[model samples]
Target: MIHFPEIQSEIQFLTKINEVELHILREDQIYPSISGNKFRKLKYNLEEFSKGNYDAILTFGGAYSNHISATAAAGKEFNTPTIGIIRGEELSEKIAENPTLSFAQKAGMKLKFISREQYRNKSNPEFLEKLKSEFGNIYILPEGGTNELAIKGCEEILNENTREFNYIACAVGTAGTISGIVKSSENQQIILGFPALKDSGFLSDEINRFTNRSNFKLIKDYHFGGYAKVNNELLEFINDFKRQFGVTLDAVYTGKMMFGIFQLIQNGFFPKGTKILAVHTGGIQGNEGMNRKLKHANKTTII
Candidate 1:
């Protein structure tokens, strides 16, 4: 079995003038690379991989995907080769400029860049056959590493300490983490999800496929344009947040969730006496790549 230390999250109360108490579950402190929800999602997956005879593992992701980076780091730790089927073929020659891809490569993940159309066919039988022929027998992980096993791992995120909160909130990515949390949450506790992508209403159905719990709300107003897209207001919040709390949030996932949580508080979405627990799903490593893009666009960079 792959060993993972039990992480005890520290709860820091939000400094606000309301009667409601807001606290952050520091999931980012779980591990350096496999920190936050990634650690939970990958725990069982890596253990399963360790028992398999597959020589390599293949997974899908975009330029700064946390799943891709975590898989590469896991492969390196377990002495298994990894193959990353990257989203954009144009990123092939720009590896040097892409921090995420470069990190994967240095961690020994052999990258295979494909067109957006091809990437969409990642799970197609023909695509799997073609990849198997080229890379030999391999264990495949879905995009974002979200699966039944992954959700099972995420179910352990909350414990006795979190049961008292009126609402538990997190950023929804592939919906696995939220699914796990909803499944484990008490019937009286509300699970709120803040999607970092626009038009993510589809996540409701996707999350339902994992568990039948209805004690949840998908708050969709927080996405800053779309996935991986950010503006100055969001950038300023991220920077100011770090300075205030000393916790660096990734612009893509956790930052958006935090932004939404604060906005919701200010907008009176929650009752005055409501006690909220906001999860900090770590993806801070992607900040480097995001900063590169920001610099290229002449936009304010995220810290």
Candidate 2:
């Protein structure tokens, strides 16, 4: 049996902003490697794998994908074989220089790199059939690990301790985490999602597909550039935030969300006396790889 650690993420109070009680749901503390929403998203999937007759677990991700890192760690801990279908073919030869890919490879995840065009066809029937042929009896987890089971696992993120909050904020990637948050949220609470990608308006449709609720809103201005893209301001905010709160926010997700949350608060987005809970959906593992890129470009790195 695959035993999951009990869901006991601490709700930490950050500070008061315009009379809004700003707090953070520290999902990042759930584990050392497979922390935050990654743990929630992968829980049931791994459990199903443990129960089933599968030869290996396969998933897709970019070079610095948190899903890839978390899935690799989980596969290692659970003693299951894993295969990572990486998006960039060029990265195959550069794995030694990439921390995320190197960690996944060290965790026994077979790495398969594909061109961007081929990766775009990942959900295509023919592409899936070819993958099945290449890796027999493999259980495939979608890119970002967002599926029905993942949504179900994410529903557990909110519980009695979080019921009193007036707003819940989380970083939106594939929309699975917020969908589960929207599902389990009280009717009076508003769920806010900060997308890390530009032109991410379609995420509303994605979230609606999982749940029929309408209490959530997407804050679209904080993406900076796009997925995995960060600016010096963001990097500085991340470093300053860590200095102030002692909480490290990953650049890809939580950092952007927290930055947006602070900006919204300054703009008086929330009513005075409202309670806001921001979910720290961890992606800190990607920092080392990101810093490597930044250092290569002679740019600022996350501390």
Candidate 3:
């Protein structure tokens, strides 16, 4: 596993109204090669595989998945062959042309794709058996890199963060990062999730894939539009946040939570003078994907 240097800071936002405290937990500080939530989630998947004496690592992701990128980096760092099972049939026709797929291949990893329906059964035993038949003995990790062992490693992130926080918030795509923080922290802290997508009742199912119970709520309205989708408000907030705090907020994940936090504060959801800790789950590399999805958001205005 690639170990990143510790990065924790008390950031003061120079807002037009007043300063907001965004306790930045720099997962990026971990390592540029394998940083962010992807690293946290995959760390223990690797651990589990090693403990089991597995030959290689096999996992899932999309075109611009941080999980895939980090898995490639980690597998390479650990001297393990990695296989990426991507989504969609477009991969079959022109597999190498896809930038992410290409990068996965170039990184000494193999990239393969299946039908959308097949992708649904990725967690099923039969599909896993099929994978084993083809690749020989290998380790299995779920998509979004969410697994029980992964969440266990994620807990360490919060333990190492030296900040006294009243509320801890994070952008939840798979709920692993949020769950890790909630299950690891003291009872005095409350965890909140800002989903980056729409219609996320299925997120509960994903949570069940990890632990039985957790202290967290998914604030669904902040999605702006949906996963990878963004609006003018989100973009404006991104611009303003960068201008104000000298920190970059990507539209896919952190941008959604940052804007949602502001709106929540305005709506009297997060009261003033409360210490709020925001986990910057780094998917900043996916900002290019965000640019594409923003075009479909329908309400266009200057960011």
Candidate 4:
């Protein structure tokens, strides 16, 4: 019920140096749930479904994936059946085991699983063939819920407020969203990406293949650890961020990139007083369990 429109430009940063301000995209501020770049990407993906009748929309996600949750919400919104191909096999587990997964199931999404290795080959012919044979005529969504069509929706995030900054920064995962942001971004604003995956070793190639261009750079060292992994420093920053800004930070993706941004600023990457914008792509649903544990840990420490 957190209306993001009201939170527009709500996340302001007064850096310790020169008191420079960095604005946060916090696109998820409006919905928190089913908000963020997911809503943007799905707005168009499901628009055609509005006209045509389909049995279901099939997408991929990890055990606790924001994309899966958003896809379920979109399916519910559009009155379409959704099937989530989760990456691991835990279908028989109790709902109490994983709330985010349960929420997706409650949204009426059927869950399927492939091995970790098979998941790596999810988009390959053998996998799609197996899915098509099993599910029959279902629409396929790429892992991380990113696709070329998703770009059209993702780019719209910057439309209303353009040319407001000299640079734009976002956390990149599958590169679809970042590539789209880079393409539609004002040429004047330098778009930079801090990846949440280790080394992002192949990230530049992934973006080029996704966007068919070679105009971007990837800052790979920001991952801290591999995707969905975190460490002590991130938790410290998340706590300090809450104390300072009153906004909770999730560990996996946004926190790492945010930590990277602050470090980059300290390292003097951006010119003094340069205007910069950072996108707070949301995935709070995945954090509910992690936060609970973290809070207990924090309390235990205080005790």
Q: What is the lDDT of residue 161 in candidate 1?
A: 91
- Scored against the true structure, residue 85 in model 4 reaches a CA lDDT of 88
Q: Clash pairs of candidate 4?
A: 3-30, 4-29, 4-30
- TM accuracy, model 3: 0.86
Candidate number with greatest lDDT: 2
Task: Write candidate 3's Cα lDDT for 66-160 as tens digits.
Answer: 88878888877778789989888787676454555666677878878888899999889999999999998888888888878888877866864
- Tens-digit lDDT track of model 1 for 102-166: 99999999999999999999889999999999999788889999999899889988899999999
TM-score of candidate 4 versus the correct structure, residues matched by position: 0.88
Give candidate 4 misplaced runs (Cα > 4 Å).
Answer: 1-16, 212-215, 292-303
Residue 224 miss distance in model 1 (angstroms): 1.2
Model 4 — which ten-residue stretch has the worst lDDT?
1-10
Task: Give TM-scores for every candidate, taking all chains together and pairing residue i with residue i.
Answer: 0.96, 0.98, 0.86, 0.88
lDDT of each: 0.89, 0.93, 0.74, 0.73
List, residue by residue over 266-291, the lDDT tens digit for candidate 4: 88888877887888787767777566
Best by TM-score: 2
Ranking by TM-score: 2, 1, 4, 3
lDDT of 4: 0.73
RMSD (CA, Å), each prediction = 1.3, 0.9, 3.3, 3.8
